[model samples]
Target chain A: MGRIKTTNNQISRREIIIEKAATLFKEKGFKAASMREIADVVGVEAASLYNHIKSKNELLNIICFDVANRYTHKMEEVEASKLTTLAKVESLLRFHIDGMVNHFEEVYVSDREWKHLDNPYLSNMQNQRRTYRKRFAAIIEEGIKKKEVKKIDAATAVLIMLHAIGGIESWHRSTRKIIGKELEENMVTFLIDGLRKI
Target chain B: MGRIKTTNNQISRREIIIEKAATLFKEKGFKAASMREIADVVGVEAASLYNHIKSKNELLNIICFDVANRYTHKMEEVEASKLTTLAKVESLLRFHIDGMVNHFEEVYVSDREWKHLDNPYLSNMQNQRRTYRKRFAAIIEEGIKKKEVKKIDAATAVLIMLHAIGGIESWHRSTRKIIGKELEENMVTFLIDGLRKI
Candidate 1:
């Protein structure tokens, strides 16, 4: 693999530390992975890491908040598309599916080990997650009102759909399992049938 | 609520410590919750807790293994039910849902914090989970053979179903945000519909 060479005089050190720490946290988990290890991974002494970040908790917040921000921003773009609620969900599912495929490690770090975040970061991430859930819920609620979907709890339906999509990162083998368009088609159809009124 | 107490001498001090520790571990998560806090919750000195369990990690092993054993054993019983594949999945879903509702603490403790388990325990639990998933996969495979279920990857189908049911612990809240039964019925219909050939 190519070494992650930080620009000597351009990019901020805090940004570098956050980027390197995200990879470490993803590999070893938030608790089991140490600040010292992250520092080493970033090509710096342990003490030097504190110059850019206050603690391990801060790094977690940065990475999680960063991902959550980007994910919701991506959703905003999707929501703007002239797509039906069903189509919006399909595109959203595809975005998440592709995102997990490309960023599988980050997904694991954020989801499985979120308990490591300190109070402020934890609360912020939780609120962001609630917002993300509400986006899909709102779409489902609209569909139900329009009689486009069967009567169902919009929140629960969205939760189930999102979890099923999120689960692909954990369960997909990539090497042994099918992939590309076929896999996407199968996942979309399965999710749609599960959510659609018909 | 009435305290879980007993007059029987068969429940040793060690068991009490483990039970209390499991409750704390589930509520606060394995890594964040402390051993000293566990001792305080159990009304014993932290040092005294060592007499019953060697380390915090060991205590986690005991709780995880215990729940994994229970979940796997119950999964086997569900697999043995004399019903069609869809009915069997419904039974499996009911078992996990009811168990989570009744033993909410134990299931929560074992599931959300599974990453804390080390070598043997982690591998053992992983195996147990794979077996649990395989039970559903087998049912899907059987359905496919009988031409009742559409052709699909048994493992993926099983994963979708598991996500649908296991996700309840995280998503369910008593508030009027969602009517729980409607959600469950939608899940059942959604899954069954997805597996039906067009």
Candidate 2:
């Protein structure tokens, strides 16, 4: 019971660090955001921060890979579902927008600051990203083959959907007159409708 | 004749500095890139860089505003043209893709690095950007009224187009498999076809 309590404390403490780090990373960028600053935000001594994480890069790796893993895992579930290609595309678009809305800092940092990651990890992240995109394009290819989607280039379509959803980063900063549900619906109509065969 | 030669030399020298600065800014980011490093790339002494530009911020301003002016000017021409609304959108899309292909570094730096500009200039650039987007949206609005465009929200449509095109930066780094013209045509079909009234 004592060990369980200690483990729970450790997990929550780590979560706090990551939550603070994401904000700093998003605001100042990964290169400019310091671990000490993150610790300060978390109300922990800089020295204590090392007890939970090894280095700044480790914190970054946790945030980036955490977001990447969520995406990949979601895609796997999506692939396993019985939904039609158009429905699957809608699911994916909803997932992307919901991720941006709920975890704006983590998603934004993962999208923008992944470049600051170092060697082996950087290449590994890139591989994961490329694989994810390939799988996404494969879905579009399937749609085209099944006559569900138009004959447009699958890679280009995937790029359009992904990047267009990423534009929600601006919406997050704007007056946001368009609420989240409306934005998602508009985007889905704009993208999925664009992919549908005439 | 002497005065004309001096003016030409000044213009060419300034162009060289801005070109080199754009490359460096794109690589290292505006804040991280040094004027000395930029001067190094231009084969000039660090001190001599100031003879051509007042500061690094000035260099960034020139690159950003130059691209913005090109875009705003092109939009003005498109607005004044006799083309249908669909044709105007096609022209705008073509202009955006062509700018990315031809002036990749400048456009990338302007899009990514303009946030680093100091105040007055920052707000000024923001206003210019907002105005540009409003104008773009106005074109779409006109299209919808004339039944040239589907009744999608014009702001969302503009966001989709611009951000989708920005994803070409990834293509610029990736394998050269999809050539520029093909990419533009594919994108045009994907975006414009979606916007056409059924």
DockQ by candidate, in order: 0.36, 0.38
The sequence of per-residue lDDT tens digits that candidate 2 reaches over residues B40-121 is 7787778887887888889988889899999989989999999988888889989999999889999999987788787888
Question: Per-prediction TM-score, please?
Answer: 0.85, 0.87
Tens digits of lDDT, candidate 1, B57-158: 998887777778887787778777778776776777766666665666677778666767888878888778877777768887887787666676777766
Give candidate 1 regions above 4 Å deviation: A1-20, A172-175, A195-198, B1-16, B172-174, B177-183, B194-198
Could you give the C-alpha RMSD of every candidate to the true structure, in order shown?
A: 4.2, 5.0
Lowest lDDT block of 10, candidate 1 chain B: B189-198
Docking class of 2: acceptable
Task: Supply the DockQ value of model 2.
Answer: 0.38
Clashing pairs in 2: none
Model 1 reaches what TM-score against the true structure? 0.85
Clashes of 2: 0
In model 2, how large is the Cα lDDT of residue B28?
Answer: 79
